[model samples]
Target: MNIAKPNSYRSGPDDRGHFGIFGGRFVAETLMPLILDLEKAYTEAKADPAFQAEMNGYLKNYVGRPSPLYFAERLTEHLGGARIYLKREELNHTGSHKVNNVLGQIMLARRMGKKRIIAETGAGQHGVATATLCARFGLECIVYMGAVDVERQQPNVIRMEMLGATVMPVQSGTRTLKDAMNEALRDWVTNVHNTFYCIGTVAGPHPYPTLVRDFQSIIGNETKAQMQEIEGRLPDSLVACIGGGSNAMGLFHPFLDDPSVEIFGVEAAGHGLTQLHAASIAGGRPGVLHGNRTYLLMDADGQIQDAHSISAGLDYPGIGPEHSWLHEVGRVNYLSATDDEALAAFQLLSKLEGIIPALEPAHAIAKVLELAPKRPRDHLMVVNLSGRGDKDVPQVGDILRGKSK
Candidate 1:
C-alpha cells in the first residue's frame, strides 16, 4: 500500500484556536485557566513520542484500531451506481466510534494527574465509552445526561451504570444534549482541581475541538491506508453524520485538501427543516453556544430553539466550529436526512447488508442512497458507520411497530 504525503489541512485553528473565527475560548473567566492548563498539557503530550506509543497500544489492545473498510457489494448492487464501502467503526469495543476519543482523553486526563473524569452525552454512547475507560483506568467517572435522553436511551444509561460510573440526569433547558453539556460545564467549574472534563465530540471551546479532532482523526488516517491497500487510490467521496461532528471530522479532515474527494456531512432533519429539526447548518443561523461560535438553531429573539430528532445522538442545535467553518468555505457539502429517511436506511442496511447501523450514521446512509444512484458505477464512496444500532433497537422497534399498526 502507498501512503500520501501530509497536506495543508494540519495548519488550522491558529495560535488562538480560532478556525477562521468559528472557534475560540468563549467561556467563563473561571474556566479560562483550566482550559489554558489543558492546552499546555496537551501540547506537551502531543510532542512526546512516548505518549503516541502509549495511545497506540491502548487503541490496539483496549479500544481496537483500524476498523474494517467493508465493500458493501449488496448495497452497491442495490443502489446500482457508485461502489459503496462502510468504515465499520461500529465494531469497536464499546460499540461506537465514541470510544476512540474517550480512550485518548482518559490518557490525557491521567497525564494531567486528574483523578476524576466528567463528561456529557446525548445518545449515551459517549457516556458509555467514557465509563468503560474510567473502569479500565480505575478512575472516578461522572456522566451528565439529559433526563429525556436518560428515558429514551435507557440501554446505554444502564451500560454506563454497569460500568460503575455515576450518571446524572439534567432536567434543565430542553432536557437534551445541550442541557446536559451545560450541566457538565458547571460540574467542571466546581471541581476543576481534581477533575478533567472529557468532552465527547469535536466541539467545545479551544483545544477541545482541536484535541478531540486530532484523536478521532485516527479514523481517517486508517481509512487512507486501508483504501490504498484495497482500491489502490482515494475514494471519490466520503459521508458521515454530524452532531457535534466528531466522526465526520475524523473522516473528512484527512481528505480536505484532496479536491478530487467530495465530502458530505449529514444532519438530522427530524420532521422537516422547519423549527423541529436538528439540522443546524441547514436551518439555523450563527450564534455562540457551548463555548464556540457555530451555526445554531435559534429563534428570532436569539434564544436557543429546541431541536428534535429520532436519533438522540444527532439531536443537537449546533455543530462543531470546524464544520461550521468548512460549510462556509464550501469545502464540504452539508445535507440533512429526515427521521423517516434515516429509519428506512437503517432497516435497509440491516436487511440487505446484515448491518444494523446506529441512527446517526443511518442519516449518512440515507444521503448515500440518494447520491449513489446519480454517480457512475465505478465511483468509489465511503461512509463512516460510526456506531452499532443495539442501543437504538428498542426505540426503532417501537417506531416500526407503531407504523405497522
Candidate 2:
C-alpha cells in the first residue's frame, strides 16, 4: 500500500507520516482495500454529530469514562521523588483500558451493519473487552489468541468464552502475540466484507491508530482536569507501556505539544536490551509491516522478527506509527526494562500498594522506581495504570518460581 493518503482520522499523523518520518500505511495488497474502507468509515463516523453523541454516551455510561486521576500518597512517600499519581484505568470495567476502544469499534460496527465482530488479543484483556462489548451489543464475536497466551492467561480466555464470543487458539510462529496478529489478518482477509476487525491496540492499519487513540484519549482528558484540581498544573511527566502503543497514545497524545510535560514509553526488554529475547525499540531499525510504516524488528530482507516478553501484552516487534514518529522527533522517549526488572516492580506494587497491575503496566512501575528517586519529591508523575493483574497472577507466579533466585 502507498504511504500517502488523504484520510485525517489518525490524529497528528503526518502527510508524509513519520511523526517525524516514522508513520505511514504499510500492509498487504488484499488488506489495503479494507483498510482504506475502514479509514473512510472512521473519518465519516468521527465527523458525524449523531455518531459522536452515541459514542460519548456509551463511553460515559457503559465503559465508565473519566476514570480518576488518583494521587498515590503512600507510593509517593516510598519513591521520595516525584509526587506520584496514577490514572487508574485498572478500575475500568473488564479490568483494563481495553473497554474504551472496544466500545468505539462496536459502535462503528453497528453503524456499518456488520454481522460479526472479530478481534486479536495478547494478554486477553482486549479479547475479553471485545467479547463483553459484543455481548452488550448482541453481535456475534470471535477472538483470535495465540495458543501460548491462551494457555498462560486462561482466566481471560475463559472470560471471553463466557461472554458469548468464540475463542480461536492460534498455533504458529512461537504461538505468541505476533502469531496471533498474523492469524487475525488472515481472518480479516477471509471475512472482510461482513466482519469488523476490532484490533485491541493502536498498531494496525490507518484508521485504527487514529480510532483507538481518540477513544482512549479519555485518559488524558480526565487526567487534565484531575491534575488541575489537585496539583493545580500539568504534570511534570507521563509514563505508560507501549504495546502496540494504545494506552501510551491515549495518555500521551493530549500532552504531546504541551512542551513542559515529559513523556516516557516503556517497552518490554524481556531478558535485557542486549539479549536475543529483547523487544527494545532502541535496538530496532525503522521498517514497515502489519499495515503501517513504523519501526519494526526486521532482518536483512525485512521479514518481521519474533518477539518475546514476560508480559504477553508487550510481546510484539513493531509499535504504532505515531509512537515511532514521537520517538524520532523527541516528543517521547521510548525506553526499555528487562522482564526481571518489570517482574520485580510487579511484586513491589502488589505488595506495597495492594494494586497488582497488569504486566504491561509493571514496566512503567519499574521505570517509575528507577526515575522517581532522581527527580524532586514534588514533581508530578502520572503513570497510566493500563490494566489490572487478575489475568497475570498465574504467569507472575510461574515467572517468580522459575527465577530460582
Candidate 3:
C-alpha cells in the first residue's frame, strides 16, 4: 500500500481529484453531472484573469485580505524560546479564516448562475461568512447547523439571521458538525438544479477540497511575503489547528516543498486521545465519510464514531483527505491537545498577549507553548490565530465557573 511520493508536494489530486489514495468524486450518481459542471466552471474561472481580478477585489475590500502577521512578543518572552509570530486571521471581516474560502465559492456560484446558496457549519464562522457574502450579493442563503452548535454558537447564529440567512438546526446523529454536513448534503441533492452548496472546509468530494484550499491559501501566501519582509527569510516552522483542516492546509501548503521548514497540525484531543476525542490521524483509521476517503473515527464494526471536543469547530470525526494524505506521506506532523490544555492556552494568550483566540487555534497555541520553549531563540515559528474568541466567551465562562465541562 505504498503510494509513490510526488516530486513537489503541492502537485495533488490528479485529474481524477485524488491526493494519493485519498480524495475523489465519491457521490451519488445523480450528483455526478452537477459535480462535473461545477468542476468545469471552476477550471474556466481559474484560467480567467478577470475572474481572479474580481475575486482579488472582493478579498481586499470586502473580506479584508493580507491579515497581519504580528510578533507575539509577550507570549514569546513568557515562553522563553523561539520568536513566535501569530498569523492574525482573526482580524478578517467575518472574524475567522472561513471567509477566505466562502468568498471564492460564492463568486463561483454567481458565475454559474446559481441563485440559492446552502452551507453547513460547526462553530458558525462559516455560516456567518456565507450569510455575509449572500447578503452583500443579494442572494438567498440557507445554513444548516447542528442543534447543539446552534445553542453553543448562539452569537454567530444570530449574526446569520441578522444577515437574512435562514438557519436550520439539524437534530440527527450526535447533533454536531457531522450531522449538519449530512443534512446539508441531503438538501443539496434535493435542490441541485438551482442551489449551490458552499462547503466551509477543505473536505467534501473532488474539486471542493482543491478549490477551498486554493482560496484559503491566501493565508500562507501572505505569511510568506510578510515573513520575508520582517525576518528576511522563511520561518523555521508553521503550526495551525485542524478540524476539516482548511486553515492548516492554507498555511502549510505554501511551505510543503520547503525542506527546511517544518509543519504541524494540531487536532483536538477532547479529554485525551485514549478517551473521547477528535484526533483523526492520531486515533482513527481509513474510512469514507461525507463523500471522501480519509482518516475517520470508527469502532471495530466500522460504524462512524462520534467525536468530542470542548470547541464545537474541532468536533468532527474526520480530517480532510489532503491531511490524511499528508500524514501518510510524512510531509507534515500531526499532534493533539486536550480540552484542559486548549482552555488554559486560551486564557494564557488573553492574559499575556491581550489576544483572545478562538478555541480552535488555542489547541495549536497549547502545543506551541511546549514547542516554542524547546526551540532556539533564533528559531522562527508562525501560528495561525484562525478566529476571534468573542463567540466562545459565554461557553468558556460557563465552564470556568464550573457550570459546564
lDDT of 3 at 53: 98
Q: lDDT for each of the candidates?
A: 0.93, 0.84, 0.96
Best by lDDT: 3
**Candidate 3, pairs of clashing residues:** 13-18
Q: Mind giving the per-residue lDDT tens digits that candidate 1 earns over 70-163? A: 9999999999999999999999999999999998899999999999999999999999999999999999999999999998899999999999
lDDT of 3 by residue, 115-169 (tens): 9999999999999999999999999999999999999999999999999999999
lDDT tens per residue, model 2, 314-397 = 988888888876766566888888888888898988987889999999999899998888999778999999999999887778
The segments of candidate 2 whose C-alpha lies over 4 angstroms from its true place after superposition are: 1-11, 15-20, 278-280, 402-405
Superposed by TM-score, candidate 2 places the C-alpha of residue 341 at a distance from the truth, in angstroms, of 0.9
Better of 2 and 3 by TM-score: 3
TM of each candidate vs. truth: 0.97, 0.94, 0.99
Which RMSD values do the candidates have, in order?
A: 3.7, 3.5, 0.9
lDDT of 2 at 145: 92
